[model samples]
Target: MSTLVQLVLAMLTGGAFSTIVHAVMNRRRSNAEAAQIIAEAAASLVGPLNERLGQHEQRIQVLEAENAHKTTLLDEAIGFIRDLLAWAGRLLPGERTPDIPDTLRDELQL
Candidate 1:
């Protein structure tokens, strides 16, 4: 081959190789930057989500405490009414309030 023709061929090959390498490097850098941005977005959301979860837990505990208190009050009221029924049964045996069976009344502690 002529020297000038060989030189032109070499220049073309070098230019093509340089272009391919640059494209590969640019794609890799872009991918890395995208991954970093996603990580940052996730980190920013973590604090607010954790705080909301903690607040919900505290509210659930408060509601549970109030429900327990109400349950105790209801239990006391039921016991008082049961005692009143037992006393009435004893004091008014002749009045015929209802035909409650003796075994059932004993089971109820009446």
Candidate 2:
């Protein structure tokens, strides 16, 4: 009787231990699966966002280059206008007083 009781108790203890182990393993598996799902979602988002960022950077570079070109042209135009005005000023006779309108002189600072 004592030997039979000992065997039954041993069997019960082994079953309980196995159940606990199975529960722990199942929990770990679920946690790992959740982590994998989150990682995959983040990875999926990375590709499209990276592509968009690259496109935006390229656009900004293009706009900056265009702005630089326009600024250079504007500077050249201003210089050309200044040169023409200086040439005109030099051609006019210095001693002879030209008829200058008061408003025009004030506006042009002549």
Candidate whose lDDT is highest: 1
Summing lDDT over every window of 10 consecutive residues in candidate 2, give the lowest-scoring window. 101-110
Q: Give model 1's TM-score versus the native structure.
A: 0.63
Query: Clashes in candidate 1: how many?
Result: 0
Q: Write the per-residue lDDT of candidate 1 for residues 1-110, one digit (tens) a residue.
A: 34565457558787575556566767998999999999999888998899999999999999999999999987786677678777787899766565556655554555
Kindly report which residue stretches of model 2 are placed more than 4 angstroms away from their true locations once superposed.
1-12, 93-110
Which stretches in model 1 have alpha-carbon errors above 4 Å? 1-13, 92-110
Superposing all C-alpha atoms, what RMSD in Å does each candidate have to the true structure? 8.9, 9.0
lDDT of 2 by residue, 22-103 (tens): 6676799999999999999999999899999999999999999999999998778666755655677788746454555664
Q: How many residue pairs collide in each prediction?
A: 0, 0
Q: Lowest summed-lDDT stretch of 10 residues in model 1? A: 1-10
